[model samples]
Target chain A: MHGMINKSIEDLVTIQFGADKWEAVKKKAGVTETAFVSNQSYPDAMTYGLVGAATEVLGLTADQVLYAFGEFWVTHTAFKGYGDMLMSAGRTIGEFLDYLPLFHTRVALIFPNLKPPRFECSDRHENGITLHYFSDRPGLSMVVVGMLNGISKLYKTPAVVTHTKFKDKGADHDEFLVNWGAADQK
Target chain B: MTDSAPMLDHGQFSKLFPFHFIVDADMRVIDTGSVLARVCPKIVPGALINDHFLLFRLASEPIKAFNRDFIARQENTLFVFKSTSTDLMLRCQVLILRDPERYLFLGSPWVRNPTELKALHLVLQDFALHDSTVDLLQLVQATSTSLHDAKQLSEKLEQRVADRTAELSMANAELSRVMRSKDDFLSAMSHELRTPLNAILGLSESLAEGVYGDMNTKQVKSINTIAESGHHLLALINDLLDIAKIGAGKMELELTKANVEDLCQASLRFVMEQAQKQKINLKLVMDNQSVMLTADERRLKQILVNLLSNAVKFTPNGGSVTLETKCDLESESLMFSVRDTGIGIATEDLKRLFSPFTQLDSKLSRQYAGTGLGLTLVMKLVELHGGSVAVESEIGKGSCFTVRIPCKGLDTLNQHNPSGTISLTEITPAETLPSNTPLILVADDNEINLMTVTDYLRANKLRVIQARDGLEAVKMVREHIPSLVLMDIQMPLMDGLDAIAHLRADDKHTDMPIIALTSRAMVGDRERCIAVGANDYLSKPVNMKQLVKTIRAHLPNDETL
Candidate 1:
């Protein structure tokens, strides 16, 4: 869940989600090598890929992962409350995202349930290499920590918030938190 | 009290009051007079004045409406009176005197009754009706008189119109008759005079041409003079006849488009030869190439020939006669001029140039032999073309005779193509003479004309016989198998046309070529001859050339040997 392995998963999820909204975005983003792999039980391949990847790493079901991802994605992706934003703009959510914040405030009131996550940093040293995790759930602790490390390596920001705190703990809850963390970055 | 002694006279008061009665305010008969009771016994002295308002109705409205005394005393005892005997209504004033309770009254003048007013209105209506009746009568009388006068005036106007119409008709008839007689006289005179003249000309021509025999020089000269004089006289006669015809509105022009230059040249050539003999230089000054003029070509040529020849004749030796032509563009007229540096005419003599038989100088006239009709005929010919001729001259500088003739453009000349050349193929030969050859009897009182015609026939290989007069002509036709005859129309014993008619009646020479040879140049002579069965007519002194041509035309061949 750290290093290349975790970074690959996050990259796949980003490609799947971005391509699902606009097919041309993946090609324009230069991510042709990325492909989706999911649990067959999930109905939508792109959604399953996003959720199953997070779940495998964090230990959560597809529904919990997707819901959490949707919320987090709406709030921090510059496409927050995009559906309601597009409604006010007389366009679709994808069109709202393309237009970005000029229309973001018009729909900011619609996504009241979505909030920014809290952040915690942890370090684990192994084989003389150090690994970091930032998480709000114990269940998704390893996944969130791996994703944050990948983000931090890419953005050079170790202090970035990746998840919100959870009162309960488990792999499912951790997977949810990890998915939420991925949405937040989006 | 003093009046009480006289107040007992009721009968006297009755007569004075007449039919007077008065009423009080409460409808009681407050005062009365005996005369009112006597005038109407039905009205008692106390007859309650129940119908007092009836007095207002009987009175004139103005009097009743404006009675100030009655209007002021509504409750006062008022006196109301009526006089029945006089057909009058009266109202009297009742005044409260003495005690201011007892009433005293005085009667006023009566108002006229409605019945008397109605009678007066009826009398006025009768007068209006009577006056209207008299007016109606007067109007009827006036209208009747006006109608009578109008009828008389109309009749008089109609009579005047009828008289004028009748007078005009009579005048027209008289004018027509006179014109007809004049025409007849001219025709007869032309014929009578021309017949004998033809004989004189014929005989003289024959003598001059030496057809009878040769003669001494003096005799020949005399005969030549006679022939020449006769020919001149004939020309004068022709001119006089033309002038008469033109005056009578009988002369008509045969208009054709002709070449003016050619005509002038030909006319000048004819006269210039004579001018050369007189030592006069006849010159032509022609600037135009050719001008086509619509006119009687023959008459136009006659005019030019006359003027040029006269100019030549009057000019002395070495004098020049010039014929010039100029065109007036504005008027589209061709002005032809014959200017002569000859013995110029006097101003007085210039007026006589176109006058018939009027020569300018008697001495000059004696030198020249002419009928003085040349210029007259020239003027007439010019006038016939709707043109004019004028003369400009001084006594010695010479004279110029200008003729201005209206001209049509050259395009119009195509209508009259003078080169009337007919193809030989169109010339159909005349009918062949009969086997029993027609003995054509030539008759003229003049023996030379007879011989000339017979000799012409003989030269043409035709067996022509002769006669001396119409009687001989008729006799010869009867004696021979004559199929055609040429008879002199004016011969002794019988006229040629009459002889031909008599022969035609006998069925002997009915279809003969009894060509009338006469000097009668009048209009109807040829037609008259043909009417009487003359096959053709030839005017004299007969043109030998034309006579031969006509003879050949009629008798194509001598098949009837």
Candidate 2:
């Protein structure tokens, strides 16, 4: 994996908690990298370990940490060029959900080694839809729901996102039910 | 085909070269893409290329005309263009074709963001969805993220370093606290252990001396054994503490000029009574008529005592123990050696002779009763004075322990003293005991030390008064104004130091002799005692005989009294 993923994890944890808490997480993870280059390649296990260790250090469950990281990833780090690209994908939360597959395909072309999860938006409507997510990696299904929530908030159309199915539960892949619009408004 | 028609493959061109335009040698656009004409409004079939756009790199180079050579050289450099109408940046690959003498501009919009495409009125569908634009945009984003991460990591690392530094300082403070507590424990332990031993030996000696009334031979023998064993235990404790202080480099050697002849006779006379009781002969040999060395008199006497006692103990009833002294002007040192003819030590046992807490044949057998510290203490004392001690022994022949005192590098000098030299073959006190009875003050908090000291003074025919603590001692001194004071240190209410301070403060008693009796044989105990106005220092289990001698030496010789 590129260092961008690992660096994203660090940025998210530090912003949410504090520098001390992030240090505790890194220590728990047994990570030795004092500095990380954004474009340098790193082992995938480092990022995974950071997420797992952050769960323990921050007194949060594994899924909760991943979800929080998912929300933080968009607001804190994915700005400037990537931010504009995401904004241009769709004008509304429903449109963005419909366009998630094409956006990720474009991203995979830029990052050749990236194993982006394949997204499928089915039963799409103005108010609600089921977002199908298939990935070679396990876990992080809750992260997809969190990312959707963040995107909905970015578009100012708050959505209630819940994991409808999981690969760990013997389903073929993970799925999330995302509902938004005036009826789903908080 | 028409002359102004685009001369490129029609089928493959639309998909791959959808953004290209053909220009002739005159720099006029001969033909342009259908998509380009919509996206870029200035592009027409006959419009001049430079009139609508500016090339970023070639504008600064020395070139009047652009050609295939220029295009080939500029291939590594991305040829970026700014549109005059739309303000959009363009990057193109220039291909010079020979068939129609035209430059094929195969390029795409170079915007890193999608919203910028909106400014040009173009959508994702307009560019055939090529992956190049996507890769470029992602590359720009990654660079920005890397810089942000570096800054964040720097700040966090600084915070972590600060936390660690604070922890280290706390640990250092804790270590200092522990060391201070350990020193206090040693001081307290010194008094706690030796006080009881003082009582055991003092009472037993009093019993054996008939002060408490004597008994038959069996009872006398039992009392003697207790006193002897108690003294032995006291010696071991003193040696162990002295060794610890010397190892720590805390022992103060009070350097003074000592006469060679005096030191030799003192060594011989130290063991005179024991040698005589065993019917062993003692002799002294001197290489110089008179010599003086800068040394600690008290510590030098201690080394001599260990040597003389060991010699007397090893020499048989019919044998002799000889002490030899020499002043080596070449080496600038004074030498003292003790030779004894009795049961000589074996070669293997001699190797470990100076190691403390070790006994060879004496360990299992009861023939010899000793703490095995005498020689060890002697070696350490000599080394503290920057000297060396060695031994030579032959089984069945005898053993000889020789110590050389080096005179160097300290506040010490070797000199030849003619007046102080008086070689006496006999072991006797040069000055007779005080002829008249003198009033002496015995001050100590421990009852045993008080009784023992007063008894010794009384037995010497000197009138004695007792003060159990420093306060009473000072009060008695002011009232009766005794001729001399024997002060025991480490007392309750007021220590010997504070009491001496009080007594010395008075003008009339300024010259009065005060001797400090301390059981804490730590390195600086004597120096502390003397600094407070003590005339001399004594250590416990108090030596009654030495106590009497010290009193006589301090009191006026009837002329002043």
Best by TM-score: 2
Worst ten in a row by lDDT for model 1 chain B: B121-130
B225-262 per-residue lDDT for model 1 (tens digits): 88777767777777788778877888888775666666
Candidate 1 docks at the CAPRI level of incorrect
Write model 2 residue lDDT over B418-479, tens digit each, in one string: 22223345432221234445778888765435545654564456766767688988988998
Q: Write down the lDDT that model 1 would get.
A: 0.55
In model 1, the runs with Cα more than 4 Å from the true position are A1-186, B1-158, B348-352, B361-365, B410-540, B543-561
List lDDT for all candidates, in order.
0.55, 0.74
Fnat by candidate, in order:
0.00, 0.45
